[model samples]
Target chain A: MHIATRMKTRTQGGITEVLVLVNHPMDTGLVKSPITHKIIPAHFIKTLTIAINHKPAVITDMGIAVSKDPLIAVKLKGAKSGDLVSVDWIDNEGMTGHAETHVS
Target chain B: MNLPRRTFLKQAFSGTALAVAAGAGLLRPTQALARTWPTWPAQSFHIKHWRDLEHSLFGSKPVVSGGVHLHAPLEAENGAVVPMVISTKLAAPKRLALAVDHNPYALATLVNLTPHALGFFNVRIKMGKTSRVRAYVETADRVHTVDRLVKVTIGGCGG
Candidate 1:
């Protein structure tokens, strides 16, 4: 789970918006190795869960259709600067990544 | 820190088991929100053709309409990340989904908009080749669609 994620949270008019960007190859398993010319096995993030103050808000199950290093943006009820927002994801390979932040 | 090698293997194995359960249609999400916001069937993600995807998502079939607008490039330099935006004149769109005709799996992102959020969504997605990118939008009662063709000079499916 060597995922590097960046999150920015902003609140306006009782609405909190969180933007999350993840770093992953998102390998589709459709491309071939230039040298070996073999179809790489399909491996991509299968599920992503987002929580506001530890309450699940957004849950996404993605496949190879997602681009490499996917972007996920979520909107929820407004939270104070110290409120917690977290994102957790598990890929098709079963590797998982988690990150959390307090609103700025 | 990354997980230990043994733990990684264990997680991977369990993931495979979960996938198998999903494949058997036993891996349904228990949350109420997911139930309200529609999601594609687990296997439908691998559909190779756009028409099949339409049938799966739209129930009957999606009609070509001008109610929605797709903002995407006529040509993309990097197939790995082709930027796109979607908007609709239709009143209060509830969900938006993207599908690539030429990609190995046609269905891409399926976005469910919160009631408070406006019906505008922007995303950067992968293109396997030069293909038609279709956007499907669901409103209160019906679904509307529009598509744009983009040329990918460089392939992005992992080669």
Candidate 2:
């Protein structure tokens, strides 16, 4: 459940968009080892939540079927030019990753 | 006396004509039928993870959103790493996720944003085969999702 993330922002039509990419294997346990012929145990991000300036914004419940290195995009409320946004997530196995970006 | 011979000959000719027509129709439409729309499985799904979202066990749910857009190649040369992008058009967005059908694990990625997030993301993923990629966006009060199909040339995950 090791996680890594990157964030970016852009302005369009007076609104700001935030994009993020996360890295993880997200193994679904259904996959078998190519050589050993054994099924890999299911492991993926289970719960994810987002906050803006310490306010809860979004939360998600996930399972093992999610793809590896999932990417996410979200829009923030009241985000204007020149603001700093913070992003973070935790996986079912308790691994966490965080990133930040400045709005332009 | 001669009536029977003439009648038999007429019937045989008509029957042969019908068979030829049927064979021509099959050849003309076979390729079109091959590209028919995808169908959901018939049985019920007992999905324990995101990867099983397309099976009969996992029911279909409507996803709503106005800001999230998902972009990926319509056809991928490799199943091991297909490039994709998800972008939000909202002024400020709070959450984003990627869901896929026909993959062992369907939920591919999730991201939480702080106040400064502008709502855009990109990455590459291993696809089991051909699949529809779905992007879920969570804003202040609602969740929205958009989907696109990506055909994988090679099976990812050693499928």
Candidate 3:
């Protein structure tokens, strides 16, 4: 129910690179619980949006095939060092996570 | 210092460019973002075959073409977490997707890039077995794609 995110940004020349790591089980529904020995329900981020300075730059539609603790990177052409890079994601179960940081 | 460019972007998002796209019915009405963002291609993810996935996502099978690059290991030591990077050489890449031919669900991820962003992405995915991984990029009128074979030593789907 609770998702944690970490974001790092770097700017060189005129491009700003943003990398985000999201905390999630990314269960494939085929994976069985080690304790219960039952197939875990599918739980993964479905829609992830990256915004640069409040303008949506990239949107990712993901599935259970993504690795656990998903790491995503995006590049913005005109984003500068002080621009704000934000990430917002919603999972299949309707849970959401948000994190933002200034590009550095 | 950034106020002028920020103001221009604000104007573009609020009134001119995106609004025109929406007014021209180019943007999907179902998107909750109230902008030109693409709706999740839910059916594409459920497909199991490469041909079907291409059909479901793009309406037809795109010919294997250049300009789209997929960076993945020739042999993935661990199927649980295989790092992949995809980029396009086209001037304007509208949509990009990655699919694994052998996985139960072939579609890995779909990306829609706005005008402000570049056509490059880095992520990791799970593979069921040794399979052909394909990356597709869509331009205004053409869809370019490329694929690579990634051998998984241990399958990742069975837990």
Candidate 4:
């Protein structure tokens, strides 16, 4: 599966707002396929990492309850223009995706 | 010359072995020590009720307070995509977590933030039905909680 990630950052008054959207199915394994009537194996992002200027800022450990195509936002203090904000996530199936953007 | 080449090969092999070990979940020194990633609470998330989730995560009942703000719609048109935002003016919160009272799994997401980061976050969650969603903000001394009741028009969990 080709997982896609997009990140956006905006800095104002020393606080940078970071928004990230990751493309993932986030199946809970409890749901069954409509046509096949088979249980869909659980596939979701277990861990998500956010970094500012290559330094770890926030680490989110998620469960199956999180929505599909997860959209996460966090605010960073003391961030400035041109600071790099990056996001990475690993799913239950060992798949990973990464995206980075600079604060504007 | 031969001795130096052999030493270089040995060092390179050991480095590769270390990388493999880390990938296999054997050694995670940096992650454990530097807070690069917090361990997922699989057992806590498996709890199905509000009390059980609270006991597992906080070791006691957290105090319900207005210090934490939970922003969510009174009625979610789609249970599959319920937007939730949590923010607090509390100082240097160590952790933030969410739980859905009526879902099969109570615990939704837990975030570990560094001291420098703000105590605010926004995310989307799924609701099996109309349920109460709770957010917990843990500081050094206390665990503050806030909950909101949301009516879901359609169930999110498909069978």
* The best candidate in terms of DockQ: 4
Prediction-by-prediction clash tally: 0, 33, 0, 0
Each candidate's interface RMSD (Å, one decimal) is 4.2, 13.7, 3.4, 3.3
User: Which of the numbered candidates is closest to the native, going by highest TM-score?
Assistant: 4
For model 4, the docking class works out as medium
- Which pairs clash in model 4? none
The digit string of per-residue lDDT tens for model 1 on B2-95 reads 9999999999999999989777653333232233433435777878888888787777644658788889999999888898777766767777
Query: Candidate 1 vs candidate 2: which has greater lDDT?
Result: 1
Kindly give the stretch of ten consecutive residues in candidate 3 chain B with the minimal lDDT sum. B26-35
Better model by DockQ, 2 or 3? 3
Using alpha carbons, what is the TM-score of model 4?
0.85
Taking all chains together, each candidate's TM-score versus the true structure is 0.73, 0.53, 0.84, 0.85
Correct interface contacts retained, every candidate: 0.29, 0.30, 0.84, 0.83
Top-lDDT structure, candidate number: 4
- Candidate 1 reaches a DockQ of 0.34
CAPRI tier of model 1? acceptable
If both were scored by TM-score, which would come out higher, candidate 1 or candidate 2? 1
Give stretches of model 4 more than 4 Å off. Answer: B1-36, B60-62
